[model samples]
Target: MKLNILSGLIAAALLVSGAARAATQLITEEEAKLPPPKGAVATDRRGILRGPKVEFVSPGDSVSSPMRLQLKFESFGGAKIDPESVKVIFLRTPNVDLTPRVKPFVQADGINMQDAELPPGDYTMRVDIKDSDGRPGTAIFTLKVAPK
Candidate 1:
């Protein structure tokens, strides 16, 4: 019994180590193609938005429950973004009518920040923004939260 347990532990360790190495390798490959500092465009299921580089900083690409998601974005266009037109809401749930728990605010530097605490569930967080000229764009970020 002791030998079997020892072998299982070793196998588990090896599996975990291999998975970590694979993840690290993927990150390095993605880092090479990261968008430029300025004039970056985010394109996802909701179409494309020129300029206004969007970056999801928190809750990471994937997260567990009881997580706080953070977003930071910049606008590089002719018209100023309408603060009232900024919204973050859930997607693909019929009759859910759920919106982000936290209200987003724009900093003086023209960057928009949104943070929200979420429960355990799969979420499609979609952010919509429109400029004063009524030019609109949407950014989609996927979140998976495991039950804690």
Candidate 2:
């Protein structure tokens, strides 16, 4: 189904912020290390979780300057999952800093994100999404704001 234009913008933002889990939100990696996509992973291991697809869409290396962008998310390939169950989050972690900037965007059925504007900078992003049945999926992304 075709979603609203802002929906695309939100998806792009989520994509840019890969650290944000697809439908789940958390700060420390410890939480991220847990089993994901609900029933998809019966065991806990450090790797990709299977479920909804999340992608970062802007402020890429190609960017020459600071700009405001949105994160994007899409659901598919799961076993009869509901978009409403998905959760979206954006976490900013720096290289030297042990603590990451944690930001919760939104949670909804199909897609979730924020309308806030951000300046240029390098940030480690995370997106988390969980199915209604408890399945969880998360994605990691990097955003480099270049001299545009």
Candidate 3:
């Protein structure tokens, strides 16, 4: 009985350690080193329908890894934000689609990622969102991760 209990405790500890490692690997080193896309113009065109606005709420220009990432979303003209229409893209040569990884934390109000982990480097990201009326919106931001 004692041996069984000891093995169970060791397994549980290993699982917890694996989870922590996974949480800190949002972007891989190879992916982060890709070349920038050519003619990448981060512009948002406003049409008759107003688009949703995205604003970063924390970790100003530079921050360390394993930080909380908060973004606020606002919709205008009586239109509600469609959470399902949100897409996150890492602006690189072949834009890395981060939607799948971040879909769990996305909401109509905003995106609140509790533990966002990335390597020490400069990263650029683009967020695209649409309102219920199909009005599209885009926001581009940069995050500088300081070395540990």
Candidate 4:
């Protein structure tokens, strides 16, 4: 009887450890299946909790020198967003090398904004936003930068 109880305790401990690891694993955009056509904002709901709803705020399709861009994320389905977890990447841009750029400034209310003095050209950027619980959302937009 003692041996059986010891075996059962070991099994329970292993199960609990596995559950903890699963809960801390971060979910990626592809795994979450959150792509919503180009230039469209989308929310990911594949995780245990729903992600934020992303929206574009500034810098229309056409822009000029001293480009300023803004992306706003709101909690969807009562999810809490982690503003510091926001990230923006320059997917493609003419006459520019894709290097490590400065991180965008995140607001207290889940708004990430960046300002850059770019040359005359076109650019495409991707934004990734996530919640405090590891749920992620993504957005892609293009900018036609013209000479000011």
**Candidate number achieving the greatest TM-score relative to the actual structure:** 3
Which window of ten consecutive residues has the lowest lDDT sum in model 4?
23-32
**Residue 121 of model 4, lDDT score:** 62
TM-score winner between candidates 2 and 3: 3
Mark the regions of model 3 whose C-alpha exceeds 4 Å error after superposition: 1-24, 46-49
**Tens digit of per-residue lDDT, candidate 4, span 1-148:** 9999999999999999875443221122232243323553443455534566678787877776565656677776666777667666655212122223434356635443344555566555666777766778776667666867
RMSD of each: 15.9, 14.1, 3.0, 16.3
Residue 132 in candidate 4, Cα distance off native in Å: 1.6
For candidate 3, report its TM-score: 0.82
Name the better of 2 and 4 by lDDT.
4
TM-score, one value per model: 0.51, 0.40, 0.82, 0.55
TM-score of 4: 0.55
On lDDT, the candidate that comes out on top is 3
- TM-score for candidate 2, please give it: 0.40
Model 3 lDDT, residue 139, Cα: 83
Between candidates 1 and 3, the one scoring higher on TM-score is 3
Residues 1-148 of candidate 2: C-alpha lDDT, one tens digit per residue: 3577789989898887874433332233343343333232222324535555556665446443324345565555555344444433334211222112223333343322332223344445555655544556666665554433
Worst 10 residues of 1 by lDDT: 23-32
What would the per-residue lDDT of candidate 3 be over residues 1-148, giving only the tens digit for each residue? Answer: 9999999999999999888655635577888999888886567674544677888787787888877778899999899999999998889988899888889889989998878888899888888988998888888888789887
Per-residue lDDT of 43 in model 2:
23
| Model 2 weakest 10-residue run by lDDT | 93-102
